[model samples]
Target: MATTAEYNLGDFTYPRGWFMIGLSSDATQTPLAVRFFGEDLVLYRGASGKPHLVGAYCPHMGTHLAKNTTSYVVKDGEHVQGDSIRCPYHGWRFGPDGQCDDIPYSPKAPPKRACISTKKLVERAGCLWFWYDEEGGEPDYDLPEFEGYDEPAWVNWNVRCLGELDSHPQEVIDNICDKGHLEPVHGSLNMELFENEFEGHVARQILSAGHKTLAADGGEPMTNDTWYTGPGILQSKMIGEFPSLMLIAHTPIEDGKVKVWYGLSVKVQNTEPTEEDRALAAGYEEAGVDAFAQDFEIWANKRPCLNPMMVEGDGPFDKVRIWYRQFFNPRARAGEFQKRVNGRYVVRGTNTHPWDNAA
Candidate 1:
């Protein structure tokens, strides 16, 4: 309910990216509703064996599509098969595209305009994504490429966890840039700080954690690049900034509720994933989870939301936080920020209000 004006102390754009709404575990035989981009959407597989995203609310009388309570029918391209979804209130039939195909009470057939809003849905890498913004303005940026994701070299495994926090999305992103907290929060991995750079809405931190070895020397800086891509996507990379080393974090907030999906990728060799590798990955992930819990505990106890009003030195990583705000601030005056040749936002200086120059 907080309008952009009310929350706008400075300009910032909403981060944008594909967010994982539900796990394969949550959506087995029934249609599941997940919230993203400030709206609830029902995700279900169509009869054609493809996934679909439909508005959660029924257009006829605003009943939730989930209220139908019927299993989805797995149909071919031609007709409805078994376990189809039907509204209990009126037996109206909706397809995976959220179309109102059958109106049992109408003798003249359902109106053509009775369909629900269908989003651009993509299912990749064992997850589902829906485009929550307008299209045709620019091609959705490609997901950062990660090496050895499906190739040979290092072992790869992933774990998806559901996290609810009483903080804003920006707060979570700050954790990625907060280098000083690594020692105290995650038990001192002896992370050594390096260069920090901000471009556009993206921030990159080059540092080395003592635990991870590089090359034959056993200790080399592990370069991690953390990016905030407009509305909700926060992505990071390890070693190098290639697409193959990518870790995507999608956080969406609606009505004071925040949901986050942490997508991680690691290079794996040809052999099976070893238990030691799994344990190490799990340990890193758990550390991230614990750190987030600490932040949630603090944010929930705060009065107003944590952005726009942060004190001068409350956050030592305030530079990164301000960079993030400038990157995503929608009120940002258009044409003021430019991208460098390397494809990062070009910062003119330390000034946060880029629009101050706007006449």
Candidate 2:
């Protein structure tokens, strides 16, 4: 088990996953640039109706890809078609792969080396994900198994919200394990705290809660499991190992302000949603929004260090916090910590927890 005191805030990285950029309906024919993973990336549908992500800034002179204003010359100038984004300042065109394709003023094509990097992109479950590291490392870990995602038994309702917080990623993450705050902040009961584990680049915390509200009555006390992978991915599942419901949240924008995006999937039975079913689904979505808002209020007011010093008895779920630290801290990655597993002390990187395999 890891503790809050052991977490190294500096080494935390965002996990890779499809993060919703507002909503799918908002995107039209025009290209839009969104801040993600500390950089601006452009998102637009290719001719094939699939979405694509490219560097937002032109490699030449740093002009923004979205700021250029040139009208299309064909079919009454209604559509814009080109192999790459054209820079308004110098008319330099960059291809989909972020490579410079042409310079209008130059006599010949631009050098092959003149190109901005293009990130590998995918749209899944109504969200966009950019691979910050290597391509095809493994199709992202399987999305949490939820009943509503593909089954007709349950109706799935999804909601998207954005919050700007003055806290680090870790601060927001710690909220999932802070069992003490649920009663007061969320008006929920604290059932019990389970163990947390850190394995490879993934950190997980399992929490049980019951009787949070009347609507949640008669329902099983949900076991919320949060998983953190290297870099920028965060996922939360509402069921136990058999995750019947799942939510994926990501911080696409960095700097002093963090932009958080959430997508959820619910399991529904075989039937159209009735009024009661709709109300229940809506209540769940509202609960999630309110819960995150509560966390945002606290994190926004915290100091930049994000991970405040833990005092005695401050975190009853300190084990989860510590496990996250051991799993993610660069020191642990470098083999600096000895983790005990199955009554044996093993190097941090070599030992794998059951959750890691399950995830």
Candidate 3:
């Protein structure tokens, strides 16, 4: 796999953005080990019912905080106390803010530097949203509200974790502008319209087409409006027999590897969904996952495309790559990258083209 530097993305190895680390159920009172942005991290829910993310190693003796199961601290159920986590080896307790709050054996107060680094975590929509920034800055933008979880008319998404892949996320991100793949990979038919709009940290794709995987049983064509809130957190609205708010999230596990997940929150006729309605929604979600797997399979096997061999009919791949570069560089220079590629691009060959519509 190619590295981020090989693609010439920017100075940072990983982009600064809100990434989905795991499903909400994965975080509980018991500490769980997780890796993201090329760092070992631990995730645990507090007794107060709030989830937290911190560096995996204890600051004192470099013990794997969540990796120990045989320690007395873990067996006695003292590994997690209230909202703080205790290191298994030395019993050093770190609060949610990542400061060393207590040291049981220490006669003196905790040292000034006795702390493990913490991460900013936001739990929403049954997923743990992690804000990752190399510069250690606050989130520049907010995560798009996955409101289906709260809405009465929509069935909440199951949010399946589709395991990790040994490919750079740049390959998956390129799908935003992969108009050529629709026909062959997904059996996209009669592409009436296809366009992409890039502005600020958002990259939008508008497509009107018929898909074998997504719109198989339906006679009506599907209209897909998809956008990435940042480098990760892709949300798409599918307009068809049943409208769905689809989610595709991928977080970097290492420089050239990533983990991905897919969910489809479906709208039903019921104001308050019945069991049957939920079952129907689950079926839709399965179909959506199947559609996404088409792309996932290709990304898993293909070599990295550092530079695409662009052609006349291809969508604006260069523009999409430039728009993505903003998240990798320093936030102050983000506008510089945005200004160069912020505009709507409509490619040729679709029925929406002037020549195609003519007699």
Candidate 4:
């Protein structure tokens, strides 16, 4: 089990991006302990309905903010006070900015050093995302939004928390450009129109694929458009019988371990779908999970590819690898890497989006 640093990614151990920490429903009045980017974090929803993310330990005495076993600061069985959370050990109240605003025991004002470290947390697309950066800076880009999430015609499934896997996230990210594995790994037929576009911090892949499970009459040519907002969040829109959006996010938990989340939404034929339509949606979600599981099984069973021996038909693996490296380096060093390896690459098809009709 080699660490991420052994791959020679860059100066940073973890890539900087908007990584999915938990589901939107995970944040309640009671704080939940989350571990991502190799750090324990506290996640909770405020009275204002906004999500807050901060380091788990209390700065005063180093107590876990969300794991208090005894009845201490919890009121009504929840340890939430407006938008601030109190330390169960010493009753130190910390705000969303990770600053200690009140100390129940101390009469004087809290010291400047009594502040917890905070990260930018945003709730979108039925999930909670945190912007992680080694420099502790603002998000370089916003998370990708799906308009269907707010529309009446769309019905979403509960986010599937896949928990932690003993594998590097890079192994999963490599699947985006892995066109050679479509037939062998995922059982897709006529996997044509394999193209990838890299623009700034975003990357996209478009293809026309088909699966036997999706179409009973042999298979139909379905347009699939998959794109990554940053280094972690990948969303895909599949156009076949109905418009569908799927989300796959992988966040590093330790040097060689990663946490994954899966979610899917489908457009209803009518505002209120019939029982048949509901069954179709359920089957669609299950199919999406099974598709990802194929790659997960391979990742868990294979050795780390510190340096890959890619072939011509393997797709733009080298270019995608370099694009991914930019995140592991500081923003200042990203430009140098981008110049060396940055540009749109298209093969077997044009860069036009395949989800235009679906959207």
**Stretches of model 3 off by over 4 angstroms after superposition:** 213-219, 354-359
**Model 1 spans > 4 angstroms off:** 1-16, 24-29, 70-85, 134-140, 145-147, 153-156, 187-192, 209-223, 229-231, 239-248, 268-270, 274-359
User: Tens digits of per-residue lDDT for model 3 on 1-359?
Assistant: 99999999999999999999999999998899999998999999999999999999987889989998999999999999999999999899999989999999889999879888999999999899999999999999998788577798899999998998999888989999988998998889888888899999999999998766556663247899999999999999988666789999999999999999999898888899889989999998888788889898999899999989999768889998999999889999999999999989888888767446521
Q: Which is the leading candidate under lDDT?
A: 3
Ranking by lDDT: 3, 4, 2, 1
In model 2, the number of clashes is: 18
* Top of the candidates by TM-score: 3
Model 3 TM-score is: 0.97
Q: Which of the two candidates, 1 or 3, achieves a greater TM-score against the reference?
A: 3
lDDT of candidates 1 onward, in order: 0.51, 0.54, 0.90, 0.81
Expressed as tens digits, the lDDT of each residue in 1-359 for candidate 2 is 12223344335443334344545544444767677667787766655666667777766778776654464422232222444556556667676777787787899779887787676666655555555422224433443333355456455647475655555555666654454566677655534444455564455656555645632563346667776653355667776322345464655365344567655554444366566766666666676776677767776675654345665323423444444444334442423332421111111111122224321
TM-score, per-candidate, Cα-based: 0.69, 0.72, 0.97, 0.91
* TM-score (C-alpha, index-matched) for candidate 1: 0.69
Per-residue lDDT over 1-359 for candidate 4, one digit per residue giving the tens place of the 0 to 100 score? 56768877889999999988888888998889988777898888989999899899987778999997685577545477889988887888898888898998788999999999888888887788888899887887777776578677677755798767888777787877887788788777655467777777877888776666665553666788998888898989988668999988888988889889898888988887677766887888998898889888888889889888977567787878888888999988877766765666655322232333211
Number of the candidate with higher lDDT, 1 or 2: 2
lDDT of 4: 0.81
Task: Please identify model 2 stretches exceeding 4 Å from their true place.
Answer: 1-28, 69-83, 104-107, 133-147, 190-193, 215-222, 229-231, 239-248, 271-279, 304-359
- Model 4 TM-score? 0.91
